[model samples]
Target: MFHHILVPTDGSPLSGMAIEKSVALAKSLGARITFLTAVEPFHIWTDNANQLAYTREEYERISKESAGGYLDSAVAAAEAAGVAVGRVQVETDEPYRAIIDAAVERGCDLVAMASHGRRGVAALVIGSETQKVLTHSAIPVLVYR
Candidate 1:
């Protein structure tokens, strides 16, 4: 039985589904949840429109706001489900490491997340934080497709 679960989201529809499912699972298990969103720091050269549009300070500010919105949504879901919840937002280039570190620091027993289900070249090129978490984490992971 999981006493505490960590749910990671990136504000995508896929992650939203994972948040809903994780809240339901936490409710069923009488467990508390920690919602986490890892925000990547702004880089000088990048393809991301948001990063390209703003200065470092502006990008950081915008990223934090976005992450807060995502975490708030998850918290609301868990609250509605009667599942106790907390949230964490971290700034990191490596979101997978941030997710794992947050789970361990927060004492979460399970890490529940969504998978984009990429394969072959797409996965290899874009890389998968979910895949990295699955590979690196010592704790249990429950993936929602």
Candidate 2:
């Protein structure tokens, strides 16, 4: 019964699977989907020790390129499934925050995303974005592993 579904992708194979699943679900429900890619800004090393420079142009270009690559596949899949689709690329270091915000901001009914399926030490050291989204998001999150 989801009218609008929000799908977040990191361009991983697991994410691709989730995208396909979301597209299929949307098609079956006659719902639209908003494909989202949260890009982390690039850090630049500066020669001067005092301050770091923020490369806004580079960040925009790189982020868009990354988003394009991810969104293209999602968009194509959704279109092929005969589902309406929207795409968004947000620049945020905290991907989970961005994902939750987009879902709420866009009035999406469901958030479907992929879990990297990390375990033990690796998961603890590098916290899962999917887990963070689950922890902080107010809406429902459907996770695919």
The numbered model that scores best in TM-score is 1
Tell me the TM-score of each prediction against the true structure: 0.89, 0.81
Model 2 TM-score, 2 decimals: 0.81
Task: List the candidate 1 regions with Cα displacement exceeding 4 Å.
Answer: 117-127
What lDDT does each candidate get? Answer: 0.80, 0.76
Backbone clashes in candidate 2 total: 0
Q: Report model 1's TM-score to 2 decimal places.
A: 0.89
